[model samples]
Target: MLRDKIINAISEVGFDEYKEISSADIIFADAVFASCKANTCGNYGQNHSCPPLSGDMDTNKQRFLNYDHAIILNKIMFLGEYYEKMESSMTEVFELLDRLRDQLDDEPVMIAGPGGCNLCDECSAKTSEVCRFPDQKRYSMEGSGMDIVTMSRGLGMTYNAGDNKVGFFMMVLY
Candidate 1:
C-alpha cells in the first residue's frame, strides 16, 4: 500500500518508528499551542520556521488541513546526562527528515520537524532578514499549533521513551 511505501521510505532514511494516520485523525490546531512557543520557547521570532515567521496560527492550521494523510516519523537517541546534546540531536533528526522527504515522490509534501529550522548555524531572522533556506527550512509541529503529546497518545505512539532518552517527531503530510 502507499502507506507502507512511505513507511519503507522513512526506514530507508533511518527512522525506525513511524505511523501512517489519516489527516482526519490528527488533533485540530489550537492557537493556545502557538502561545506556548512564543511565551517560553524563545524561538518565536528567531527562526523562520517558528511562530510569527512560520505564519499565523489560523493559516498554518488551514495549510495542515489541506493534506489528506500524514506519516509521523520518530527517532530515539541518547540526550546525554543533562541534555547537553540536544542541539546536535535535533539537527541530526531533521537531517534524517530531509532525507525522508527526498525519498517521497508524492507531490505537495509538507514536513513538520521536531524543532525550529536549524538549517543555518544562526537564523537570518535574527538579523532582520528573511529565511535564507526557505526550501529547506522545516517548521516544528508545535510551531504550527500541534499538540504533539496528545497527538502521539491518540496515535498509540509513546511520547516519552524514558529518562535520558529523547524522541524526535516529524510529520510528512501529503
Candidate 2:
C-alpha cells in the first residue's frame, strides 16, 4: 500500500519512471561529493545546497543513513538536435518531487533533485547571506554526496535510457 501510494504520487506529479528501493540500497560515497568541485557545475559555492555550502561529506553520509526508504524517480526527455533540454528535464523531476512530497506529507521527506535549487530565479547565495526559500530548496543527489550511476547499478536500474534521451533522476528520501 505504501509503495502504491508512492507510485501514485509519482504519477500524480506527471512522472512515469520510478522505482521504490530501500535507502540502504543506495551507495553513498564521500568521493562522489568530492567530485562536485572537480566537475565544477558552477553552483559550487553559489548555493547553500551545493558543495562547500552543502556541508561536510561525513555529515551528509550520516544524514543519508538516517533515512529508511526512498523512491528513485526519473524523467526521460529527447532534446531537439542536442541535449540542451536539461533544464526542462530537471524541472520535470523537481515538479514530480514536489508533488510526491506533498502526497507524503505525513512523513519526513527529503528530495534530492537533478541540480541546484530552483526555488528562485537567482539564488540568494549570490547577493544575500541567507537562502530565500530555505524550506523549499532541494539539493541535488550528486550534491548530497550520492553517486547516482553507481547507486542505480546497484539497484539494477539503467542510467542511460538511450541516445538523444537524457534521463534525470531524483530521490524522495523518507
Candidate 3:
C-alpha cells in the first residue's frame, strides 16, 4: 500500500522523466556545499537553516549510504517567474512527499528536496532553536551538498533548459 502511494505521488507530479541512481551518479557532495558557501544565495549565514550551520556533508552522505534504496523525484516547473514559481513547485513536491509519508506503514522515509525547505515561512533554526518539524522538515539535496543535475543523470533524467527545467530531489524509503 505504501509503495502504491509512492507511485501514486510520483504520477501526480508533472515530471517529464525519471531514472534510478547508481553509485556513479553520486559525487563529492562536500564540493557542492563548498560552492554554496563560497558563492551563492542569501540564507547562508543569517538563517541557521542554511549550510555551515547544517553540519557535515560527508557525515550526512554516510548516513544516506546506510539506507537501502532512494528514489529520485525529478519535478519540473516554471523558472520563468523565478521565486513565485519556485515556491509553487516546492509546494507540489511537499504535498506529494506528505502523501508518501502518510501511506508509509513502517518504512522510514527521508526526503532531500531540490532546494531549501520553505515549509515554514521562517525557519525556527534561526534562533538556534530546535527544528519545528523533526518529523516533517526535509533538507534539500543541494543543502546536503548533493549535485542534483548529475544525480538526475544517473537516474536517466535530463536537466536541459527550455524543454524541461525542473529541480531534482531524493526520497529514500527503508
Candidate 4:
C-alpha cells in the first residue's frame, strides 16, 4: 500500500521515468565517494548533505540500507546546443523534487536527489553551525556515494536522452 501511495505521489509530481528497486540493490562505491572528495560540485565540505559533513561512506550506505524499498525517479530536459541550459534544467528538476517531497510530506521516506540539499539558500555548514533544519535536510544521491549512472543503466533508465537532453535523477526510499 505504501508503494502504491508513493507511486501515486510520483505520478502527481510528474517525473519522466521511475523504477522500484530494493534498497539493498543500491550500489555504493568508494570511487564515487572519492569523486565527492574531488569537490567538482564544490559542496564537499560546505553542505550538511555532502561529504565530510554527511558522514563517511559507510554511514551513508547504512542509512540507505535501513530502508527496504526505493523508487528511482528521473526527469529529462532539453539543454541548449552547447548544453547551456544546465543550471535552469537542474533548478527545474529540484523544483519537481520539491513538489514530490511535499506530496509525500506525511510519509516516512528519505529522498536523495541530484546534488547538494537545496532546502536552504545557504547551508549553515558553511559557517560550521549546526544544520538549521536537520529534520528536513535532504540528501544527495551522488554525495551519498550512490553510483547513479551504473544504477540507472542497469535499470534501463535513461541517464542520457541524447540530442542535448539529459536526465536528472532522484530517489525516494521507504
Best by TM-score: 4
Full ranking by lDDT: 4, 1, 2, 3
Rate residue 39 of model 3 by lDDT.
42
Worst 10 residues of 1 by lDDT: 30-39
Candidate 3, pairs of clashing residues: 19-155, 76-166
Model 3 segments beyond 4 Å from truth? Answer: 1-5, 12-14, 22-25, 46-49, 81-84
Per-residue error for 173 in candidate 1, Å, reads: 0.8
Residue 48's lDDT within candidate 2 is: 78
Over the full model, what C-alpha lDDT does candidate 2 score relative to the true structure?
0.74
Residue-level lDDT of model 4, residues 1-174, one tens digit each, is: 888999999999898999999999999888887888999888999999998898988899999999999999999999989989988999999999889888888988988898898999999989999999998899999989999999999999998899999889999999
What lDDT does each candidate get?
Answer: 0.76, 0.74, 0.60, 0.92
Worst 10 residues of 3 by lDDT: 16-25
Q: Which has the better lDDT: candidate 2, or candidate 3? A: 2
Could you give candidate 3's per-residue lDDT for residues 1-174 as a string of tens digits?
A: 655565665666545554444433455466687777864556564344358766687665664576655667665565554445665666776776666556553555565655566667787766677778766666666676777766666556656546335554655443
RMSD of 4: 1.0
